[model samples]
Target: MDKSLILNRLKNIKNFATDTELANFLNISRSTLSNWYARNSIDYDLLFSKCENNVDINWLLTGNGYNVKNESNVLAEPIESSRKTKDPIYELQRVPVFNLEATMGLVPLVDGNGVDEEKVIDYISIPSMPSCDGAIYASGDSMYPLLKSGDMIAYKRIAVERAQIFFGEMYIVAVKLDDFSTMKTVKFVHQSELGDEYIRLVSHNQHHTPKDVKLSQIAAIGLVRASIRLHN
Candidate 1:
């Protein structure tokens, strides 16, 4: 795709005050944008990440769908007669939400041992969800509009030994460092050219650079099953 087309589309949608503001919003330097324009090449991944939720990914990439998302008409739930009964209480599974700080602190404890549920700060009941071991509140803009800060993500725990990473899927991975641990999304997993195993972490917001983490640093992993976004 031509980078100029994407730049024009972005300009039309945002109508930013200036090019500097647009560059800041996209988290790219002016030189980088100029380079992309000169080469007529689009960084699809970065563009998609920056325009997530607001713009239709299909339209942006292939020009096959509506430019903007129509959230209301997208997934209207079917009305069931049972829902009109006197008692409308639905069965739900309660998943514990752990404190982000404590969850990171507990990464080292997962050296073959399971997560300590004692660190959980609270619990929430969700209906129509698959079996989830725990939940965590998102912390950074790395995931941007699709998963803004404070969004709840339910995940099923995966044993370290039996963990099989699904490339291009989202995951909550705990990385063990010398004195602390951190959590991020796993974008892709593959062996390096030198035959060393590594996993790439990507942010939905393009400003954050993708990181390649060695397999040795991974302490625990969870397969993300569902996400609950609480809008203000």
Candidate 2:
């Protein structure tokens, strides 16, 4: 596959945006954009869905495919059944995982597998795992000694019942920045003896120092119930 052709197509169809500008618009960094420049081809469905319609998938993927929206119609649930189930109650659903790779430089998973979200495999339902909105496969040795890259960590969303908790507790937290969401393991946020509030997070590895994040920036929190690491 000719990647330069796709890049050239992207440049021509970029609507006055530079490559970096186009990448950021697609919620991907410049480096990631550069990395894809060498690929022979790409899965248009997955890539375009993540890009959120900023670029023409057909043109960016297959050089000859036209830029057109593909739509399909499907049958809806029975009207009578839908009407009867008006008072729907939602239990804690599948875990929500933020993309750390394309969006950030976190762990990368198998892309374009087209896995079904509804396919609840028994492997994902271990009783030892904590109840969470979802699980995230950890990346990097930043949390080494405790968590390794590709370890599946279970998490529970922070809520009223979970707020006002004490320090030293291990939790999965989404750190919201001015432009991005960073996921990290949090130990606790507390006020020092001087009355200054500090967010303190620990590193499992001895080489890395503990980090202090501001309390005001914690977007969401979830308790870490269990983690499963791969042997190989």
Every candidate's CA RMSD = 18.7, 15.6
Candidate 2 off by > 4 Å: 1-123, 160-163, 183-196
| TM-score of each model, paired residue for residue | 0.51, 0.44
- The sequence of per-residue lDDT tens digits that candidate 1 reaches over residues 1-232 is 5656566556434434245656787798988877877889867788878888577676555444344565221122222234432211223555677765644522321221233456777777766454455688888787786688888887755443223455666778778766565655533333344334676777677888878777667766766777889868
Against the true structure, candidate 2 reaches a TM-score of 0.44
- What 10-residue stretch in candidate 1 is worst by lDDT? 71-80
Clashing residue pair totals per candidate (backbone < 3 A) = 0, 2
What Cα-based lDDT does every candidate model obtain? 0.59, 0.47
